[model samples]
Structures are given as structure tokens and as C-alpha cells.
Target: MYHYDEYDRALVFERVAQFRDQVQRFTAGELSEEEFLPLRLQNGLYLQKHAYMLRVAIPYGTLGARQMRTLASIARDYDRGYGHFTTRQNIQFNWVELAQVPDILQRLAEVDMHAIQTSGNCVRNITTEAFAGVAADEIIDPRPLAEILRQWSTINPEFLFLPRKFKIAICSARQDRAAIMMHDIGLYLYRDGRQQMRLRVMVGGGLGRTPILGLQIREGLPWEHLLSYVEAILRVYNRHGRRDNKYKARIKILVKALGIEAFAREVEQEWQHIKDGPAQLTEAEFQRVAEGFAPPRYAAQPDGDLDYGTHLAMDRSFARWVSRNVQPHKVAGYASVVLSTKPGPAAPPGDLTAEQMDNVADWSEHFGFGEIRIAHEQNLILPDVRKADLYPLWRLACEQGLGTANIGLLTDIIACPGGDFCALANAKSIPIAQAIQSRFDDLDYLHDLGELSLNISGCINACGHHHIGNIGILGVDKNGSEWYQVTLGGAQGKASALGKVIGPSFSAAEIPRVIEQIVATYCAYRELDEPFVDTVARVGLEPFKERVYARQPEVSTCAM
Candidate 1:
């Protein structure tokens, strides 16, 4: 985990003081709603359905135990005793008071955390794979580069106000766990034939009113030119991206208008101006940031734990949990564990109580080093758990309700806090997610369904990343009521693809049955051990659509 330098501390404290004044002015009526809107957004405060919401950034989804404890304290003292982890690997406190936001910001700053650039038309949190440093298939750790980007982009005057929010992700592993193809600018970091680091850049991917997978614009870029090349891309987007309509403002829209060749040409033209400028990353700077992510000390042990094998052989439940929750680590005698937030209908996806946060913080230090990670799937990661301690850790995790053995299963649904808290939501997302989870609570059945992804969004903003789920459910607004539109064949990773809508939206009550039918259709058509997404691709959506709409009356499709 990266510790804040003196400059970092100063900057955060200064921003907190500045925002404190802004909050006071707004409360005093010195600033109008329009006037305070941008200021508040810059500070990561939003006026949602019930109250102010504060989104705190967890850079590249890494957290120290102390920082996690601070977050737990904030949840306990300031707002409700919980916070919601988002698809972007950030956390949200839904019931914050506007007047006390300064206090919360101060507390966050104390832990070297802040809400800066978490929202607004600036570069949002830079993200990579949660298992970046330790993944078995990792080519190189991308965090050092991700951290460099974070330092450069935070409050960068040139990009403070773009046409729309920008997102960047880097993936260094063989498997694309970071969902890079779904980002505004996605980079694949790898070594070339000469064993030199290089980056392959993709541009124009986003999911909102329009969902488009990014197109590869540039490849074989030297690693040193990361900042310069990224700057060139942003300069092109900043200058020509649409300003008239927010709907058409994303870089994806601009890239669509201009073909990939034209877009690449524009970026190249811009790059020629500053390709060798000071923004180009140097070897020293890279090392300075990377030092923060050096590998933690580990005890010497054999490749596999004897006790771990015994537990797996002795306890069926432990075996099941290990199969779903445990992931391979590059280091011998170690593994990464995902603590599932989507346990069941009892909890909303990505949400954790303050107590839960504290327990995880303690477990991180006790089980591994004092570090934690947040996954894009909205789960917590114990990145360095020893295989020998797996049984006891599993017991503790199960007691804390974080040990649901459903990593890629049907019930581990990702959903946004829809009408329950967000003013932007068209319908309630939590209930629908709960409904689906309740219907599919059978673990044996879920595991048999095999590696399915179900994501739900309150609206088309795609906060839940519905566009990339194997079975995507999107809430839609009818004349007055809420309905859900379903899409199939969507997936993320190396072979990412956007889902296609099945047909007209269904009422909230009919969603569980609709999902059940979809699963039935998948089971009937699937070959031996074929994943749901693959099956959908092989047979197409027609079979599932025919079964889903057969008994129900035809209704007009809702305008997205």
C-alpha cells in the first residue's frame, strides 16, 4: 500500500480546508444550488434521494488496515453504520449530512484518504486488477504506473472539466480482471520481444445511454511514454468532445463520430507536440512510486499446505468455499481470498456495515500483511492469505457473513443502490437484486449453473456495470411504474462483449420468474460444462427470449 508523502498530505489537508469553507458558504445561502453544485461535486458530495452522499476514492482499489479502520469509524460516527462499495472500486456513504461533510473529509485526510475527483467531469479513480501484484498470471505489476497516473491526474488543471467523466484502467495479467475494455482508456501492459515494457492503448469504451467496447487505437507504445501518450489522447478529447449535450459528451461518442483511424491520427498529431515533454515518465519517478508497492515479507514454506489439503479432504463445505472464493497467487504457500459482499437477500450487493469493515481490517492484518483490496465485482480481497491458515480464516469469515461461496455464481449479483438512495435511479435496484438472490439461494444449483454474472442497474448510468454481465438486468421507467429490461451474452475480460436486450421490459414482480426461465433455457441448451455466456453465444438469444415472453403478453419496449 502507498503511504502519503509530505506533499500528498499537504495537498489533501488544503483541499479539505477549501471544501470546508465551500460547505459553510453554501449552508449560509451565500452560494445558490447551481453555484454549490460543481463545488460539491468536486469534493465528491452528491444530493441523492434522501440526503447527501459522499464517495471516497480507494486508489486502484488498495487499502491499508488503518485506512480501513478510519472508514469504519466514519461510518459509525457520521452517517449510518454502513457504506456501499461500488463497481468502480470506490465506497459510498449514502446518508451523510451536508454540514458535517467537512468533518468526514478531515477524518479521511487523517488516514491519507480523500474524496477528490471521485465525481464530476474529471478523471475518476484510476483502477487496475485487485490482484495486480500477486496474480499467478501477472506479467508485471501495473500499480506503480497506476499510482503515477493518479498523482499526475489529481487536480490536474488541464483536465479538471472535461465534457464528461473520464476513466482509465490498466491490466498486466493474462486474464483481464480489471474490465479494461469497458473503460474510457484501457491499457494492456506487457513486455515485448526485446523484454522491454510496452502498452497497448484502447480508446472510447463506456456504458451509459450508449454502451460501446473500446477500439484499439495504438499498440507497441513504450512504457515511458504512458503519461505523454495519455496526455495526447486527453488533449484531443478535451478540445473536440461535445459540450452542447451531456448525453453526447463522452469520448466514446466522439470516437464513434470519428473513425478509429481518424481518432488515432488526431492523438498522434497531438502527441508529436509533447511526446518528449516533462510529462514523459522517467525511470526514477517510476521507482519512486513503485517502492510503495514492494512485495511484503513472507515465511518460507512448501508449495502447498498439508493442513489445507486435509481440510479440503475432510470438510465438504470448506471445499466448496475454497473452490469458489480462493484464487491462485504467484507466491508459493499463499492464496488470495475474496470475501463476498453479496451473501444473500439479507444484504445488498457491495454494502458493508461498519462492524464488517472493522472485522475485515483486523483480518487483513492478522491473516496477511496489513493490506486489503477491493475487487471490481464489489468484494474485498485478502491478497496474501497463507494456505495453511485458510480453514480458520474461512471459519471467521463465515461467522462474519462474508464467506458466501459464490464468486462467479448466479446469486453473487452486482447492483447499484437504485431508488432506495440515488435520485438518478429509475427504479429500486436493491429489491430486485434481493429478489433474484432469494430465488436462487440454493448453492448446489448456483454452482451447477456455473460461472454466471448477473448485474443490475437502477438506470442506464451503468453504475452496476449491467452492460457487461452474463445476464444483465436494467431498471426502466414506464408511464409511471418501474420495469426491468434484460440482456444476455454480455461478458467482461479479454473477450469482452456488450449484452443484447432480449425484449420488452418486465414488471418488478415478474423479474425473478423471468430470471428463472432464462436459467432453465440456458440449462436446456448448454453443452457439457459450457459457461452461461458461451452457451448464450452458441445458441443466440432467440431461445431464451421465446421462452421468457411466451406466457406473458406483448408490451412495448421502453425507450432507453
Candidate 2:
């Protein structure tokens, strides 16, 4: 929701012009592919298996209605009719033309959007919770600080090229919807007894070949030191992080090699050098960035609305949707509505057609403020929908295929494009996700099963964030064939933990049935009203593994 000032506009326009020339040079063969590689990557362009994929950044996952429409136009005009919303809260166009990229950048610039720092080994998009300011249980709004981080890091010559991609996430809510624990740097924003803002800093968290939760490096850090502390961590990483091996380049690996104590000492030493430097955030700057995210005007309404209660009582389907997809808001008589992008086999998880995008943009204005949010779980959000507008909005959303009642259920899976679009993928993730969704189409059953997450990744890159799902499925390569590996008890949020692998990898055809057995095993052993993850924690992985492998055919040994 932060509108670009003249400086921001000039920076984006200049970048577009520079990239246009670079693109022209490459097209004319004046620049070699090797020369163009980093240039293109810095601009959020990737050469995938079939075509170039363009990833556009949605700063802190906030989007104005106009920006959403612009994205829809790009999807319609430039690539295929649809775009994939990634777990990072960014959207990817899988089939983009090499020549039209500059034009696309220009279009994005018109709406204060760009792809800068989205793909390069730089600080990627600074993400926060989708329900940042509006969540009922929020301690303090994190978007202002998130925006500050974004501005400070964008194109900072000191950190233009790091050993590997770095990600940072901040959250202020009681529930961690942003999955901050799995980021390179995670910040929990809160207020102390005196209402002085503070941060709990975590570092060295990442998911790839090696998945590890972040270790808390600092607690009760004053809000003024947010940027300074982050810079100190980056300086430490830039100096000591491995550059010889890509697999070992992430800060997580560095933190692992050096124990947390040593890592903390190094960061502390680095911070002492820059603690009071220009990077330290100031009150004036904080207020300037925060003005853009100030609360929207609202009409005073009662705690309960008669029409809303009437609709919920009359329509069971609407009630089910409200139960699963709606969230409490900070303001009375309002709620945050999650528009699920996962709609079973009709579309892949995290994908929306141009038409759907346009519809959402329209609905955003009609229902609430002209704002939309992209969730880390690959869903769209209307953060301030009035309770009185719930029924009409739900009807409109249902008409556009955006109303799926499975928010944290099995079918509401988080998945990457996998082998279908990404060359780095060893196996196909889309089909597997579709297969699982198709198998678990019963909404009643899913709701009864309680909140569960199923995440899939095509490879070890963990693009789908499979390691943190309640039931994680990873695609593995076995003798040039694709095999699926299952991990149980993974979870995100406050008690985030990485999943443990079951015995062996199963063939693609066996994934659905394997998931079925896992679910059945959970149902058998679960205590009354226990969530899937809690059941896994109570019963452990042995029972699910026993049931899955008991009646299965011979399978290859675990390779991952």
C-alpha cells in the first residue's frame, strides 16, 4: 500500500530503461548469454524449461486494486491466460516472451510495481503477514518496518550480490501466518509494557537441501536498531558465508557451521560497528513510511450485524465458508476474507486466471477498501470486508470460482510449479498436488479433519516450502524416474518444525493412496477434536508409516 514517491518512481523508470538496453543488446547478440544471465536475473527474469518466467514483487504482499488489474492485464497480454502465485507471496508468469519483458516492466512501473531483487542473490522481497494491520490479535503493525527494510535494501550496492538468495519476514500477529521461522532473517514485532516497540530477531533459517528453523539471535531489540541489526547480520554473512559451493552458501549453512553462540557473537561484534550509524531507523523516517499504512476510514457499526447473522443461519454453505475462510479483524463488524486459490483439479494451487484476477480487483473495491493482499499460503485476501457485505461478497466470489471453503484443510495445498515449468525440478509437483486434491474433494471430511497443511516441492529447493507443511510431500529423482517422499508432523507458525521423512519414496501413482492411508491412520489414533499435526506429534510417524507401507508394493529406498 506504500505509494512510490518521485525518487522511487525515478529509480524504477531508470532500471527499466537500463534493462531495456540490456535486453536489446542480448537480443542483437551484442551481449552473450553468460553476460545476460545476471542482468536478467536481477530483473526477475528466469530461463525455465520451456520459456522465460517473470516474477513480480508484491512488497509485503500488499496490492492496490489498480495494481491487481495491471497484473491481470500482463497475464492476459504477455504470458498465458493465468499466473502462478508463489509461496513467497509473489506471482510468476511461466510463459513470458524475451522481447516483451521491457514493456512489461514499464507497465509494472506505472503501477509502482517491479521485479527488482526478486530473483538475484540479494535480499528478496521483504514479506510480512497478509493480515498485518487488520488482524484482531496483532501486537503492532509490521508493514511500516517491512517497508523501511525494503527501501533500505533495494539496490544497496553493498549487498547487490550475496553468496545466495536471502529472505526476510516480519510479523506482529499472535499467529505467525508469514512463516517467519523458515526465512533467512525473521523478526517478531511487539510492544513492551511502556508501549515501546521491540523486535525478537532470528537468523540463519532456510529450506533447501538443508532445512533448519531460525535461531533467535536477539531479543527485546529496540525498533530503532532494526535496519542496523539487519545490516550487521548481512555484513557478517557476506564476509564468512561460503562462496565455493552453492548448496552451502545460504546463511543457514554458515550459522550451522559456526554454532549459534559463535554466530551471535559475530553478529554482535558487527553490530557494535554500525549500531548508531546512518542505518539506524529514525522516528521521522518510521512515521513517513507508516503513514501509507494508516488505518482506513470506517463507519461505526455494532458488534453484530442482523443481516450477517441471518445469512449465516440461512445458508449452510456460506456458514461453512465463514467458519473456514474468514478471520477476525481488529475492528468490530468486520472480518478478513481469504479467497482460496486452491480449487481442486480445476486449477493448480496458487494459480489465478486473468479473469479471476480482474474479478478480485473489482470485488476488493466493492467490498472494502480498494486493497488486496496475497497470503504466503497462496491465497488472496480482502483485509477489511464488512460483516454486512459477507453474503453478497461470498456469492460474487463463488461465481468467480474464488470461494473455496478449504483455507487450512488438506485440499488447500501449497505447491510449486515443479517440473511442469521449472527446469530445476527433478519431478512434477502440479500433478501430484492435483491428484491429492482430487482424492480429498470432500469439504465436510476436510473440515472434520481440522486444520492441516499439505505442501509439495518439485525438488529440494523447497520452493513450495514442503518442510513446514503438516503433511509434506517432496518430489525426488530415482534412476531418472520421479518418486514422491512423504514427511509427517511438519508445521509452521509459533511452534514451527520441519517434517521427518517416512521410510521409502513411492511412485507417482501411489501418492494419493499413500496420503489416504496417512489420513486414515491419523483418524484412527487421533484424540477427540485433535488437529492432524497434534495427532502426528502424539502418535509419531511410525503408525502412519506402518499403515502406508504395510500394503504397498516394493519401493525404492529413500534417496533424499
Candidate 3:
């Protein structure tokens, strides 16, 4: 994990002081709600359903044991006893007091963390693969690059107020876990024929009302020019991206309006000027930042028989979890463990209690190295858990209400705190998740179905990542009633693409049934042992859509 130096320390302290004054003004009525909106948002404070929510950043999904402990402590002391890890690898503390925000931020800063640039339109969070350093397939660690971009984008004077929120992701691995293709700027680290590190840049990919896949402008650019290249793209977007309509504001729209060829030309022209400029990262700076992410030394254990083959031969539940939750690591006998926040019978997805947070920290220290990573899939990642000790860890986790063993199953849903919490939501999404969970309770059925991501958001902000879900559900208010618009076949990977809507919107009551029908459709068409994503991709949405909408009650219809 990268520790905050003096400059980082000063910046956060000063920002908190500024925000405290702003909050005081708002509380005292010196500043109107309208005036305080942007300021509060910039500080990662959101006035939600019943109370305020404070989102804190975990840069590039990296956190030390001490920082993890601090987070648990803050969750225990300030608000609830747990925090919801987000798709951007950040954590949010709901039910926070409006007056205590500055104090909470100060506590976070004490542990070398803050919420700056976690919100507002300026580059929300520079995310990367959670398993950056330890992944066996990585060409170069993306954290240092993510940090460099984070520094450059953090309240940059030029991009403070973009038309809409901007997201950037870097993937250094052979198989992209970062979901880089669905971001404002997606960087794929690659080694060229010359054996030098470079990036395959994808620009303007996002998911909202109009989901757009990014257009690749630069391919195989030298690694030294990463920041300068990114800046070139941002400058072009900042100059020309729409500010008129909120729905049409993302760079995706701009890229679409201008064809990929034209957009590439524009970026090329911009890069010609900035490619070798001062913003271009120097070798020393890159090395300095890279050093911060060097893997911690572990006492070499005996390379003995730590076989999970015996366990796989026995416990079915353990095997299932191991299949979905474990990732290959560079170090032998070590594994990257994904602690799923999604639980069965539809407990609130991504909602963690303060106790759970504390337990997570304890478990991390006891089981693995004192390190934690948060995945972009709204789950916690213990970067280095030993394979041999997983049973004890799983048992302890089950006790603390942390074990679910439903990592990639249908019950593992990604739902926004919709109309229940968010003021902007039109429908209640949590109950829908509950409904689906109850309907789909059979683990055998789920396991058979395999690796389906169902996401629900109140609206098109795609906060729940509905756009990227294998089964994406969006809530809409149809004549003062809540209805869901579902999308199918979307995926988040190296070949990432947005899901397409499956026919008309379904009433609140019909969502679970529609999902059931969709699942059934997949079941009918799937080849032997094929995942739902693969089945859907092989067989288009028409088969699923027809089955889902066959018996729907009277409703208006339009092309999906």
C-alpha cells in the first residue's frame, strides 16, 4: 500500500478544514442547500434516504492492515459497524451524521486515507484490478500507474467540473479483472514486439441510458507517456464533451457523435502536443511509485503438500467457493481470496455492518498478510490468504455473518441502495433482490446456472452497475408505479460489452418471474456445462426475451 507523504498529508488536512467550514456554513444557513450541493458532493457526502452516506476511497484497491483496522474502527465508532465496498473498490458508510463528516474524514486521513475525488464530476476513482501486484498473469503492476493518474486527476484545475462523472481503470493482467472497457478511460498494459511496456487505450466507454463501448485511439503507446496520453484525452473531452443535457453528457456520447475514426484523429492531434511534455512520467518517478507497490516479504514456508485436491474430493460447499472465489497468485501456496458481500436469502448486497468490518480486519491479520483489497465487483479481497488455512477462515467468517459461499451465483446480486436510500431512485431495488433470492434459493440450481451477475439500479446512473451485469435491471417510474427494464448478455471482461434490454419493462411483481424465465431460457439452450454468459452470447437475447415476456400482463411495448 502507498503511504501518504507530507504533500498528501497537507492536501487532505487543508481540504478537510475547507470542507468543515463549508459544512458549518450549510448547517448555520449561511450557505443554501443549492450552494452546498456541489461542495458536499465533492467531499463524498451524500444525503440519502434516511441519513447521510460518506464514501471513502481505497486507492487502486490497496490497503494495509492498519488502514483496514482504521476503517473497522471508524465504522464501529462513527456510524454502523460495517462499510459497503463499492464497484470502484471504495467503501461507503451509510447512516452517518451530517455534523460528524469532517471528524470522520480526519480519522481516515490519520491512517493515510481520504475521500477526495471519490465524488463529483472529476475522475471519480482511478480503479484497477484488485489483484494487481500478486496476479500471476500481470505484465506490469497497474497501481503505480493508477496512483500517478489519481494524483494528476485529483482536483485538477482543468477537469474539476466535467459534464458528468468520469471513471478510469487500468488492467495489467492478461485477463482483465478491472472492467477497463466500461470506463471513461481504459488502459490495457501490454508488451510490444520490442518487449517494452505500452498501453492499448480505450476512450469513452460507459453505461447509462446510452451505454457505449470505448473506441480505441492509441494502441501500444510507450509506458513513459501514460499520464501525458491520458491528459491528452481528458483535455479533448473537457474541451468538447456535452454540458447541455445530463443524459447526454458523458464522453461516450461525444465519441459516438463523432465516429471512432474522427475521435481517434482528435486524440492523436492532442497527444502530438502533450506526449513528451512535462506531464510525461519520468523513469525515476515511475520507479519511485512502483517501489511503493513491491510485494511484502513473507517467511518462506516449506513447499510441502498443501493439496486442496483432497478437500475438492470431499466438501462440496468448499469446492464451490474455491472454484469461484480463489484467484491464482504469483507466490506459491498463497491465494487471493474474494470475500463476497452478497449473502443468501437476499440480505442487502454490499451492505456491511461495523462488526463485520472489524471481523474482516481481524481475519485479514490472522489468516493472511496484513493486507486487503476491494474488488470492483463490490466485494472485499484478502490479497494473500494461504490455501491450507481457508477452512478455519471460512468457519470464522460464517460465525461473524461474513461467509456466504455465493460469489458468482445468482444470489450474488449487485443492487444499488435504490429508492430505499437514494433520493434519486424511482423504485425499491432491495426487495427485488430479496424476491429473486427467495425464488432462486436452490444452490444446486444456481451452481448449474453458473456465474450470473444480476445488477439493479434505481436509475440510469448505473450506480449498481446494471449496465455491466450479465442480467442488468433498471428501475423506471411508469405512471407513478415502479417497473423494471431488464437487459441481457452484458459482460465485464477483456472483451467487455454492455447488456441489451430484453423487451418491455416488467412490473415490480413480475421481475423475479422474468428472471426465472430468463434463467429457464438459458437452461434450455445452454450447451453442456457452459456458463450463462457463454450460453447467452452463443444464443442471443431473443430466445430469453420471448420467454420472459410471453405471459406479461397488459403493457405498452417498444423495441428493446
User: For model 3, how does the per-residue alpha-carbon lDDT over 1-560 read when each residue is reduced to its tens digit?
Assistant: 77777888999899999999999999999999999999999989988988999999988888877887888888888876777777778888888998999999998888888998788888887899888988989888888888988888887888899888999999898898988888889999978888888899999888777777777888888888998888888888888888988888899998888887888888889999878789888899988877877787765655753455667678888887777778888888777888887775536887777677777878888887778888877788888887777767777777765677778788889888788878889898889988998888876767666778898888877888888888999999999999999988778887676888877898989888888888777777877777677888888888887777686522221111
Against the hidden true structure, what lDDT does model 2 obtain?
0.93
Off by over 4 Å in 1: 552-560
Could you tell me how far off, in angstroms, the CA of residue 342 lies in candidate 3 after the best superposition?
Answer: 1.1
Clashing pairs in 1: none
Better of 2 and 3 by lDDT: 2
- lDDT against the true structure, per candidate, is 0.93, 0.93, 0.83
**RMSD per model, one decimal:** 3.5, 3.3, 3.7
Per candidate, the number of residue pairs that clash is 0, 0, 4
Residue pairs in collision within model 2: none
Q: What pairs collide in candidate 3?
A: 81-353, 81-354, 82-353, 82-354
True lDDT of residue 92, candidate 1: 97
RMSD in Å for model 2: 3.3
**Native-structure RMSD, model 1:** 3.5
Q: Write the per-residue lDDT of candidate 2 for residues 1-560, one digit (tens) a residue.
A: 68999999999999999999999999999999999999999999999999999999998999999999999999999998999998898999999999999999999999999999899899999999999999999999999999999999999999999999999999999899898999999999998889999999999898989999999999999999999999999999999999999999999999999999999999999999999998888899999999999899988888779999999999999999999999999998889999999889999999999999999999999999999999999999999999999899999889888999999899999999999999999999999999999998988878877788899999999999999998898999999999989999899999999999988999999998898888888878887778778888888888887889896533222111
Of 1 and 3, the candidate ahead on TM-score is: 1
